[model samples]
Target: MWRSKARQWLLRIPTPKCSPLQYQVPPGTLIASRMPSNRPLPTFTCLQNPRLLSASPSFNSRDLDDSDVGIVGNAVNADDSRESEASPVNLDGEMDESGSFGEKGQVLQEFGDSSLGFDDDKVMSEAADVDSLSSLWEESVSADDSSGVFGSQEASDGVVDEIHEVDDEQVESVLSLLQSTLVEPLEASLNKMELSLSEDFAVRVIETPSISGENLVGFFKWAWRNCRSVRTARVVELLVLAVSDVPELGKREGYMLWDLVKEIGAEKGIVKTEILNQLISMFWKMGKAKAGLEVFDKFADFGCVPNSDSYYYTIEALGKRSMFDTAWTVCEKMISSGRLPDREKIGRIIAFFCKGKKGKEAHSMYSAAKEKEICPQRSWLDSLVCSLTKNDETVSLAFELLDDYAKGSLKYANKSFADVVKGLCRIGDVKEAKKLVLRMVESGPPPGNAVFNFVITALSKGGEMEDAIALMKVMEGRGLRPDVYTYTVVMSGYAKGGMMDEACKIFSEARKRHSKLSPATYHVLTRGYCKMEEFEKATDCLKEMKKDGVQPNTDEYNKMIQSLCLKALDWRTAEQLLEETKESGVPLKGITRSLIAAVKELEVEIQSAENNIEA
Candidate 1:
């Protein structure tokens, strides 16, 4: 009966209503219940037993009165509620708070009233339960809101994704702005950033074709000022590509590019010899020969000794621009540096002298090259021949050079043989020129149109018309069609021979063959007309000269004035010619001034004759 009563009391506790569950036990009852009882005296203790009280909901409260029980109960409930609020527990027994509850609950209970008489162990156990219950309640409340359902890990991941998206959009916007701003100032700013940033950024600036040349140059200048680490090779490549875009920049700022490359190479340390060579080459291509020399001077700073190829480029650049003195200095520098000049480079040095019309210097260089077993090639030999011929020197040097080739003492390729022949013809040495031509036909590759034209011109200028005509036959026999020069030479020969009819026939035949007449040919024909006293025909030649856009040289003007004064005997005509000569601004040398003075005297004579005839 007592067991049934204890059971009924437990059931009537109303299940704690999901509110704070506070268990309050009487103080003495806890000790009495815990004391091992041997006697079975009480009916409740015997039937259900205080041992069952160990399992009973309120067994420790049995020793206390109702008021003490109520007080303990209220205090316990209040403590439970406070702990629950501190850390709500999930239904699955997980805490929903920040896991800082145990310490907080200990502090709170320690500062509270001692009337409750809460045991330290009991208080700690109750605090732990309260924490668990609080966690459950928090979880339930959080579940109702969708945003709060996210775990810390998932929330952190979402924040990172948003950040990445924002960064990507910002990058895209910047790229778009770069594309749209085609102006030089803005593009230059972009290029500056690229140079400062990474290689990918630099490459983007390089690959963007929308950037104009002015902007690209400005960018390079900025880079040179700011980016001290840029490689010389990269700057050269960028400038080279940029040159094709802005030809004007090439004219104005090309030297600046060269200077910047030199600066970068000097500052960054020359890690690549090829890059140094390229930088030197770019200076030449940009027509900055002095800049190329400056680059050469910087080579020593990088610990690179000047090589033959280095001297070759520098000398060749100077030579091309007619800077013979500078070119010779470079050649001497190369030799003094203990680097033997390569045969090809030596050939270029010789060609430079030839190109500059310095025949004496060229011959010296050729002899030096030969002494070193560095045989001048055919092209070099040809240049030498042309140089000597233009200077109108005694052909003995050229003959000696050719003889060396003929004796097989110097390496003579077929082209070298042809070069000697062309050289003889260039100097108007008709007999020697013809001899060389016959030798070429006998031993070398059969003479082509170029060789034939040279020989024909030599014979024509030497007043050997028949010989020139015979050579034209030989040319046709060799299956070589005479070009315009051949025809011009033959006609000029006839004109010099005073065989006007034959020259006219040849000129007509040449026209029939559709050969384009050159300015020299017209000048020759005009002289021929003056020689025949055909002053009207000479005037027609002058009109043709104008039509062909050929400016009359001093000789042509002298011939025209002489013919007009002698044939027309008109004072006004002679004065008009003199005035035209003065207006043309051609330099009047000894022969030209004499012609002008003669024409004035003739005009005075004509005026005297008119006055005498009138008187």
Candidate 2:
């Protein structure tokens, strides 16, 4: 029976109603029950139940003033007509006697409240608490609405001022602020922000890119001045690493970053050689070789000893720019210190030095590499050998290096062996080159056509045609077919020694072995025929060159014209060759044309003088 009463009383609560004259509820609108004026109201706490106490839809704010709500827990009977006329719940008009509930007020006028059971004291207490409930709820909702969203610009704007308490949210806040800020000066942009730079924060600033490198440096500088935490060694390292990874880091930014690091390092005495090495490498990427050297020179200033990477990078920087003299000083310092880097870097160092014509100076670095038992790359080792062979005095050193190839310094190959042989030929050491070729024939990586050709060419150049011919026979016997270049070199050497018959014999052998010949091959035999004053043979060799699909270049045509006009004084043939070169669109020198005309005129003058003498 009591449960049935509870349900009846619950339905009896009033639902919100709209006014006949449309009305909008202002903020903090309130609702309350209307009671009879003739008797005291019942004690109630809004029954503290969801269904028994319903809110007016118009009173939507949780922050409404508590002054309008009061203790209404008692009920009493009144005249029916008066109650109906004064009740705020009346849909006919206003539902109150004095209408204190106002035009838009909603209430339950007669719900038979006397039988509805609620604990009197508990109900009264809950009613009193509602007075302050609105304020508390309003405060919470307002706070959340202010800062509830992610990456809110206004929420993160004041982060720099809140650095004492830090988290990922704050860090991300700072990052987005920095990226989106339009303030010209970075420090000025950060002026209003609360900044406490952690190592991780500094790293994110550097590595979380989008800000220009200049702006990043600007942010870094500002942090240095305003935040001491950013000056730590770990942060500086990450800064350097991050900067190094930026391939397009500007020179100005690099210098600025270096300055910041230098200042921090000098203050903390935490500057390291590895960090400085990283800077040098970064500068090399920036194409600042001199800057790299400058970094190298600062090692003593920082009390850090120069390590192998230090020297290698410095030399590499200078070497890439062809600054051998500057690179050599670092090389010498490395040598004197008795240290060298890994084989790849060491090989590159050798290559750099060699490219700058400092192969002899690079030898010391190579020697240090050897003493350390670090074998460089084969290409770089070959580079070192080739560099060493540039000087006649260093040729023996290169030979020793080659000899060490058998001892595991580098692998012996046909190409490297041929390089040494060519070096010997370059410095006019044919006999040694010959012996090396013979040695190659007897050993592994046995001599190929190139090896035999270098020795043969050298021998033929030194007027040792007999030795040259024997080397060619050796080439054939070894089943190494001579190429067009090989035949050309051999014939060149023979022609220079006035051995045209032997040169022609070599040419015949080249033609038999290959369908085509190099222009130099035809040039060699043509010059040989000219040197023998055999014009017919020279012309025939040139025509044979074209028939074999060898297009004569400018040098070939020029040499032929020069030989005919100057050496043989055959103007007619010179003009014919010039016209052929023009028809083929080959560019010939004007001097050769003038020479032909002069020779032709001289022949005419001699003929006219003979005619006058006969007359």
- The digit string of per-residue lDDT tens for model 2 on 183-206 reads 566677677677666666777777
Give the TM-score of each candidate: 0.36, 0.56
Model 2: lDDT equals 0.69
Candidate 2 least-lDDT 10 residues: 43-52
RMSD each, Å: 25.5, 20.0
lDDT of all the models against the reference?
0.57, 0.69
- List, residue by residue over 416-529, the lDDT tens digit for candidate 1: 456666766666566887877777677664677887787888888788888888988988887777776788788888888888788878877776675356667777788888
Which number leads on lDDT? 2
